[model samples]
Target: MRKGKWGKALGVLGGSWGAPPELCPALTAVFQSLVYHECHFTNGTERVRYVLRYIYNRQQYVMFDSDVGEYVGFTPYGERNAKRWNSNPGWMEYKRTAVDRFCRCWYKTFTPFLTERRVPPSVSISLVPSSSQPGPGRLLCSVLDFYPAPIQVRWFQGQQELSEHVVATEVVPNGDWSYQLLVLLETPPGAGSPTAARWSTPRGPPEMPPDAARSKMLTGIGGFVLGSLFLALGLGFYLRKKVRGGAGGRVPPGPERLPRQPGLSGLLGVTTHANTNVVDGRKAFIILSHGFK
Candidate 1:
């Protein structure tokens, strides 16, 4: 096989692919040979790693790691191949320049495209219901529907970051180029007002402010309380009117006959029950029930 040049650099790996198949007559089996490049982005842009690798039968055969700047072999056959390939001046020069020629050059070209494809995760936070830890609330922070899975989710109380009690889920692939994750923050925030702590994500939008969230919750509670107060006042007025009307029309507990007030009872949404005692020669007071019609 004629050795060409050691050149070319990455896409994703993020994306990984192999070379053409080679037939091995000694074993009467076809062993596939593969070649691909990988770009690893780290915390520092200066620390990005570019690698050109070769494979045989799905095992690593040889590689030109940018950090190492040479060919490395993982197997005996690969060692012989690497030694022969590394001996050439053209191979060395190509390997050395591949970082600048392809890695950095294409890296700059493709970075904006990657950035354009970046999908920010949607986040929501809720207090985790725990019968055991009811005193200090546990928060379940749901981070959902995102792309380019690498992300960091954190908890913060005002400007201070809370690291001790934070918990997170593995970046779960949603099977359609999207991802989901669930992070949990334990206690601390629950010790004070609902606005005592907040959540944050460096790669995502700023966490919902604790104060804003508290305000929304308080607004809902206030509306509920106001509605209940109005309902109670209306019910009180209705009952007061019914009582006054019944008292004025009712016959006293004397020897007078008890007249049925079915029309008034139906109108008042009440079920009326009364009894007259022959032995005592007195009429029992009427009983009104809202439960039964």
Candidate 2:
């Protein structure tokens, strides 16, 4: 009976692609609640994924039709490390692992859709100040959606249908087969109300910046950074070894060569005088005084 209830609840919250349409309202509420919690904060996708994974694992959900093959069941807990079925971990472990894997896989598959479709962005003002100031209000909020086909953008305030004031001012075509809608609002205080406002869009609210779309990009690059760090360290070590020891870590200089002196004997082509010297084999020459001559 408890299992049936869980199944019903899951049906409402939503499931893998083939989930049946006969889902109970309670089940739908569960999915709604998941969106409510998941979409309210930054990094909510990660939390939602983790929650879905937990639910799928704990529920022992079947991933595929039994007609395709044997109906493997789920094991919530992981397998014992040593227990083996012909070198493979036993059946229970395998089943549990499969469930865990599917949990991760399905979360990856559906969480974004659930987030995009379910919550829809809400740009609302908590309070509006008087038109006494130049600005529209304390904060006049708006939301722009770039959803693909079958999804439309609409605006609501306090559950009343706002038609004339609301406008689908702009539709920008994205290369990715999506259309962007810009919704605008001008909230200023009126005679009695704390907040009063209307919507404005020549085309629509400004498109969300590309940076906003690329949230969590750094997390993806983290693995590459680790690998690069290791490579750099290895190269640095090799270079240090090649350089040997020196000031400022530069390579030490090699042995110096003696500078060649000018060889007067070779250049002048004079080997010996061939004269017997008086004291140190010197050649004697007589010179007359030029000036006197």
Local distance difference test values of all predictions, in order: 0.56, 0.35
lDDT of 1 by residue, 160-237 (tens): 667887788899999987889887876535332222223222332343343344456666666666666666666676
Off by over 4 Å in 2: 1-135, 138-145, 187-293
Give the TM-score of each candidate: 0.43, 0.19
For model 2, where is the 10-residue window of minimal lDDT?
284-293
- lDDT leader: 1
Shift of residue 263 alpha carbon in model 2, Å? 99
| TM-score, model 1 to reference | 0.43
> Which residue runs does candidate 1 get wrong by more than 4 Å?
1-30, 40-49, 74-76, 113-118, 124-141, 147-169, 183-197, 203-293
- What tens-digit string does per-residue lDDT give for candidate 2 at 99-146? 336555665677566543322222332333646666434333333333
